[model samples]
Each structure stands twice: as C-alpha cells, then as structure tokens.
Target: MKLLLLKTLLQRRARDEGFTLPMVIALGFVMILLGMTNIVKSSEENLNAITQNSSSDALAVAEVGITKYRELLNQNRILTIYNDDQWNTNANVTGQACNDLTTTPTGWEDGGTATAPNDTTKWWELREDTDGDGTDELIGEYRLVSYQYDIDDDDFDSSTPPTNNNGQFSPSDDNANTTDDFTFNDVTYDPLGVIGTSNSPEGYNPTGILTVQGRSTDGSEAQIKVEIPLRINQNDLENLDPALWIGSTDTTYLANLNGNLGSLTVTDGNVVIIDAASAGSSGCSDPADGASYTVISDAREVPSISSIASKRTEAVNAGINNSIPVTSPAVLGKTDDDPYVTPPSGATFDEDIHCANISDCRYYYDLSATDITAVTETDGIAKVTLYVDGNLNINQDLGSNVSSSYLEIYVTNSGSITIDSDSTNTINALIHAPESQLTVNGTGTVKINGSVWVDKFVNNATVEIEPDTTRISSLNTAPSYKLYSTATARTPRPLTGSPTNWVREEVQ
Candidate 1:
C-alpha cells in the first residue's frame, strides 16, 4: 500500500510539470539579439560610405571654387599692368616662375630612406635620381607648393609630396632642413595671393614653400600659370601718326590783308590816269558827290616833277603821242540837256534801273566803242559821253588779254536806249554805280576808242574797261574839294529844354 501511494504521487508530479515553455523563451531571446546585431552592422557600414562620399564631394567643390577665384585674380593683375601709362617692356620690376602643377610635384620632400616617410616642409631638399642612382643629389628645386583641405576634420593638409623622411611640412622655416616641421602657420594659406610678398609680417617664408592645389567638382585637377606684361597708354604713343589717331586731314588758308599799294602820278592834256595803288581806307564813296570822298593823310604828297617828267618822256618816246582833238564840235546842249534826242528808230541798248537814291545808281549801255556817247542828266538820270574824232588808244598796264568789243558804261537814265555797234561781234560790258568812283585795281584786259580820265581811287575797289581798237588815253588828278568833311555843318541841335536828339540830322 505504501509503494502504490508513492508511485501515484510521482505520476501526478510528472504530468503537471512543463520544460517546452522555458526552451521557447530562450530561443526568442537569441533571435532578438541576432537581429539587433545585424541592424547595427548595416547602419555603421551605410554611415561610413556616406561620410567618405560627402567628404570627397565637398573637397572637390571647394577646390573648384578656389581655382576659379585664382584665375580671376590673375586676369585682374594682367589688366592692371596693361593699363599703366608708365609700363615698358624693358622695365625691370620683379619676376617669378609660372609652373604647371600637373607636371611637377609641389611641396615635395625627399625621404632619407626608401622605406622611411618624407618631411613635406623640406621641399627644397627633395631631389630626383634622374640617373637611376640609389641616392638622389640635391639640384634645383621648385618654388611653389600646394595643399588641400581635410574635409573630415576641417583642417588644411599639404597635397604636395613629402620633402624629407621627417614626414612634416612647415611654412615658417627659411631653409629646407630637418629642423623645419610643417605647421598650420608655416604654409602660405592665401588662396588669392594678392597680398604678394607681404603676406607675412616678417616676410614670406623662403624655404617654407606654399602649396596651392585645385580640383574640379567633376574630379578634375587643373594647374596653370599666367604671365602679365605691362603696356603703354593710347595717348603715350608719341611717334604715332596724327592721321591714324585723329582720322582726318588738316588744312589752312590766308589770314588778313598784308600791305598797301604804292604811290601814283599823272601829267598830260585831257588825259586821265587811274591810280592802281592799294588804298588803306575802309569804305566806298561817290565820285560826283563832292562831299563823298575817302580820307587822305596830310603826309601823302604828290609825286615829284622829276619822276613825272621821266615817265612822260618815256611814254612819249614810245610812240604813244596820239591825241584827241580838243576843239571837236561839242554836243549842242547844256549840262542838263538830253544827248540821246537823235537815237535811231530801230536800235536797242542794254539798260538797268535802280532805286531812286544817290546811294544806289543803275548802270546801262553796251561796253563797246560804238555805244560810247553822252546823254542828259535829269532828276534820276546822269549821262556819259565819249567823243572820238579820229582814233583812240586803250592801254592795259597789267598785261592781260583784251576783248576787242569789251566796254563799260554808267548812266543814271531809268529808260533804255539803242546801242549802235560798228562791229558784228557781241560786246562784253560791265557797268556799275553812276555816283560811286570806279577804280581799275587789278591785272586785266581793256580796249578803247579814245582817251580816258580817272581822278582818284577809293580803297578796295576794282574797275575793268575794254574799248574799241582806237587811240585811248588816261590822266590821274587830285580832287578839287576836301576829301573828308566834318559833320559840324550837317548836324542839327535840339531846341532848349527839349529832349536832346541823339540822331544826326542831314543838312539841306
């Protein structure tokens, strides 16, 4: 009975107990732990990849930006040098070398041994064994160095090759020795280099070379150097041709009057001499109006008798003694009588009419020997007559070709008349003022049928005459009245207390 009870209790205990629950709990814990480990490993791998790519990309972009900035700086320097007026090709300022970074390794230091690391600060000590020797001998060294930023730490690091086995680079050292170790302050950090040698207060590091390295955002490395030459300004080309600069031609003309004509004289019977001497006066005047004349200097004296006599004797001996008859029958009329009363019925003469004023007189009639005749003087008319008995002589001293039919006449008549031409050729005539004096002043042609007389010549006046193929003469003489008259006789005064009249009044 005791044995049976024990067996039953044991059976009950065995049936109530469970071992699968604990086992299932332990298996769940293990799976959770394995999953957590896989998640941590994947996260770390992804973060590492992202960090490396981000660092490389940032570095590339920064390098590209720096390169562009440097290029712009170089271009600006070149322009500044070119615009300087004092720039000269032979001028000695300062010079440095421009190197291609792609071909040369900048900021390089030589390692003491092949297995040992190099000191970047000792760039000058670096030497290439061009002859394949086991050891390199120091020769010439590159002056420029380069560096890149460590994107992971935001620190600047030299991209140039190591200079020596010291595995260091410093910009503070003046010589490339083992004592020189690269430091942040030793490298030339300026990206622009615009400050030039004054980049440091104690002066730029000689042995402590700077390293400038650039990379494009697309992963391209570029290294270049530029040369800037000074040039002269546009205005500084002293020997340049004026035509090329101004793009035009230059010209000039005569300025003012130089001098005056000399003296004149006349001596003969009924002969008129015209003075061709230059007159220094300023304005024109009338010949018939006794009050209108040019002012003459009291210092102006007539020619001496000896001079006149010599000229007259020379002229007479030249077979020029042909004279007009003084006793020829005069026109049967008074000074105011009409001389054209017997004009032919079907004749015509060139005529011009001007305003009725003494200041403006019209000239008419053909300038030919056949049209040479006298007419009457009326209120607005003045007549001119030339009487030829046998022959007339026309002398032109200026030595110019004379037209046989040329004639000049001045008449005050407002109406036309018939001009009787003895020749069939056309007559060339020039007629001017009836009251103003006409002076033959230039070298020209002239013809005459009889004698001519000219009393005086005003300043700046010219006269040309052509007469018939006959004897003509001329005589020059002084005026009979004063040339310049005072205004005292012609000016009138205002009555007392009346406003004074500033205008001058004409005398009756």
Candidate 2:
C-alpha cells in the first residue's frame, strides 16, 4: 500500500515538472522578442542622427559660400597704389591719414559713398578640391546672387539699371544718427515673410547688400546675406592730405631743379613727397598764395617705399582674387591693330565692348611677359584703361562729358609717359607706372586731371596737372580691369532675424 501511494505522488510530481518546462520555454521566447525590439529602436535613433548630420553639413557648405564673398570685399585690397593710401578713413586700417586721424574726423565717414563701398553681387561655385589631400568635394553651387541698393544711395536704381544687378529695398530714411535706425516698409516677401529688416544694430549700408545661396550634393541647401559697401569715392581721401601719395627710388621732380619752368595748381590738397626730395628742385608754389606755396616735405617720418609697393601689390592681389572672372586683354584701343593709338572718329567704348564680347578680343598682348606699353586714348569717350608693357603716349583729349571718377590708365614695365594732347582738354585718369617717369609737352593749353606715380618726373613746362579727385581709381576697381574676378563686392549679410523672427516651420 505504501508503494502504491509513492507511485501516485511521483505521477503528480511529473505533471508539475512538465508545466514548469513549458513556462521556462515561453519566458525565453519573450526575452528574445524584447531584445529585437530594443535593436529596432536603436537603429531608428542612428538613422535620425545621420539625417541631422547631413543637414548640418549642408548648412556649413552654405556658410562657406558667404565667407568666400567676404574675402573679396576686404578694404585692404582696394587702396590707390600710392600714399600710405594704406591711409584709410576707417581708423581700424589706418596708421595715419592726417594729424591723428584716429582722433580727428571723429569716426568713419564714407563721404555719402560707402567708405568700403562695393559695386555688385557676384556668383561662383565649389567644384574641385584644389587641396590635393582630397578635402575639396564636388558639393553644390550657388543658384542665386543679388545685390541690394538703398534708394538713397546716389539713386542708382533709376532709369533701366544695367540689367540684372541691384535694386532699392525701401524708401524709408536710414539716418545713421537716429535711434530708430531701421524702418521697414510694410512689404510682403516670400512665404518666409518680410524678414530681419532691423537685424543689425549697426545699420545696413545705403549702398550695397550681398546675397548668395549654396546647395550640397545631398539635396540640402542654405542662403546667406551680408553688407558689402563699396569704397569707390576718393574725395574723402583728403584726410590722407597731400592726396598725391608718391614714392621713388630716385628723384621725383616736383619743380624744375633749375627754374619754375611751368605752373601747377593744387586747389585744396597737400603734396606729399617721398624718397630723395620733392620731385622738382623748387617746391610747387601755389599760385593762389602770394607767389608762395607749401614747402615740399616727406610726409612720412621714414620712407615707406618698399613697404608701400609690397602692400599695394597685396591689395591688388586681394582685389583680383575677389573678382568675377572675365577675360580682357591688357591692350584696349581704336582699331583691331591700333590698340596703342587713338580711335577712329566714330569709335566708342561701346564698340570696343562689342568687339571684346567675342573671342579674338586680345590679339597678341601678354601681361605676364610685359610685351607692350603705350596708351593713346581715342576721342569718342573719356574713359578707358590702356595697359601697355612698354611706354605710354597719353596724347588724347578727355571729352568734356567725362563722368566723375572716370578713366584709369596703367602703364606697366615702362620707363616714361610722354604727353602731348592735340587739344588742351583736361585728361582725367589715375596713371601708375611705378618704375617710370612722366614727361609732359604740348603746344596747346594742356591740363591733366588726376595723379601720376612713377620713378621720376620730367615736365617740358607745357602741361599742367590739376588734381581731379573724381577720377575713377584703378586700385578701387582692380578686379574689373586687372583681375579674373568680377566687379561686385560681397560680405556676410547682417544677422537680423532669429528663431523668433523666422517662420515657425522654417526654423529647425
């Protein structure tokens, strides 16, 4: 009887054992499913992180676009080849312009024209990684490029502006002194709405505003804007007093060493001499004075000849780097072969531009080899830059209708610039021939309006040069004529709108 009870108890124990094994198996299955669920969740998180990283990279690419433009508009790149012209109205870049310019003129005055004024908004792309290390990627490109012009800035927006450049943003006054520095018109823009009108506490320029948009291969993109005021006007250059910033390794004649052979009149500017002594033996006597003139003095405490040349070259390089690439020959002139002489009567700059619009524009001029040197301007228009690799014969009349700040003639690798205008009309331009001399001789009443810089000066006592501050500065517009860059100036735009200002959907 005891053995029978034992067997019955064993049977019960076996049934309980079977149920336990099944429970264990079911729990094991649940554990495996839970592990899989966690893995799936982690994978989703990784995917999201990857997406965010891509977006960030796209944003960086866009920022790079804006930065590229900023480098082009740097002020240091736009100084006249002479003077400490390094002499800037902006105190930050100036060591000296006048007696303590940092203290005088109070602050930066753009003279109504931007102190660092730029012309237009330029565009470009990021394709090759020139850095052999494979850092440069064939990412994306800028789709849109635009420049804004304040209606108040010389009213440049009027009368069919040169097609597709800049336009006025509003008509409200942007008085720099007033507390309400920004006034936005109740204008509606894209779905994004009128954005960041008062974004910058330091008001926007009444001259230039640059805009550029960049995209990446990943289909992500970004846009940026910046202020790029052009420093085109030279009238404010007075602070550099002796607007004539000259330097020489040898004597730069100011007055005939032997006698006051001819006459020169600097209505309201100072004369700065560098090197040996003043160009002429006798300091230029201001006719306005009682048969007396300002004494010739080396404005610089120590001659800054080499330093000036080096800096000027750097500035030129900067301008060239920042410019839009356009192919133009050094020699520009009247006939196809007469690039060294005056144009035929009916020839106009328009004609040259039309011809240059085609392929065979540059016949055989070589700037790298210094192949030619001579500028004999043709009559119809008053402005043109004849970059010769040899000598300059500037004997043309600058038409009466010459525009302010117009014409620039640069004679590179030259020994001298001889002048004998057929007509006495004033010829305006900024002539730079660092290694040459200037010799003026004309029977008719001759007048030259602008600055001449070279190794020396030799006047036949016939031509009188009157400083016309209005001549267009080649240094200021270096990119347009000498560089592969465009004529526009660009910088990172003002940051006006924050997340609070952007559309709710647009902000991350």
* Best candidate (score: lDDT): 2
Residues 1-508, candidate 1, lDDT per residue (tens digit)? 9778546544535545664455558767998999999999999999988766654543443333233323322322221211111112212101101110111122234344221111222222324475897777543322122222121111222355432311122211112223323232323334344433333323222121113232333333333222221111212111111100000001110011112211211111111111111122122111121121121211111111110111112113221112211122222111211212222567432222222322121112222223223321112122222222221222222111231112223322221222222222122322212122223322332222211212122223222222223221111111101000000011110001111111211211
1-508 per-residue lDDT for model 2 (tens digits):
9788546545646448666556657867999999999999999999989877776666666566555544432322221111122233333223222222222111222223322222222223456665688775565654325434342333233454422212122111111112223332222122333245443222333434445565667766566554444322322223333323344423224333223424544444444444222122233321122122242333232111111111112123222111112233223222222122234577554545544533222122223223323333333232343344565565556522343224444555554667775557566655556566667775665565565545555556445544554422222432221111111222211212211111111212
Which regions of candidate 1 are displaced past 4 Å? 1-16, 78-202, 205-508
Candidate 2 residue-pair clash tally: 35
* TM-score to native of every candidate shown: 0.17, 0.32
Candidate 1, run of 10 with poorest lDDT: 244-253
TM match of model 2 to true structure:
0.32
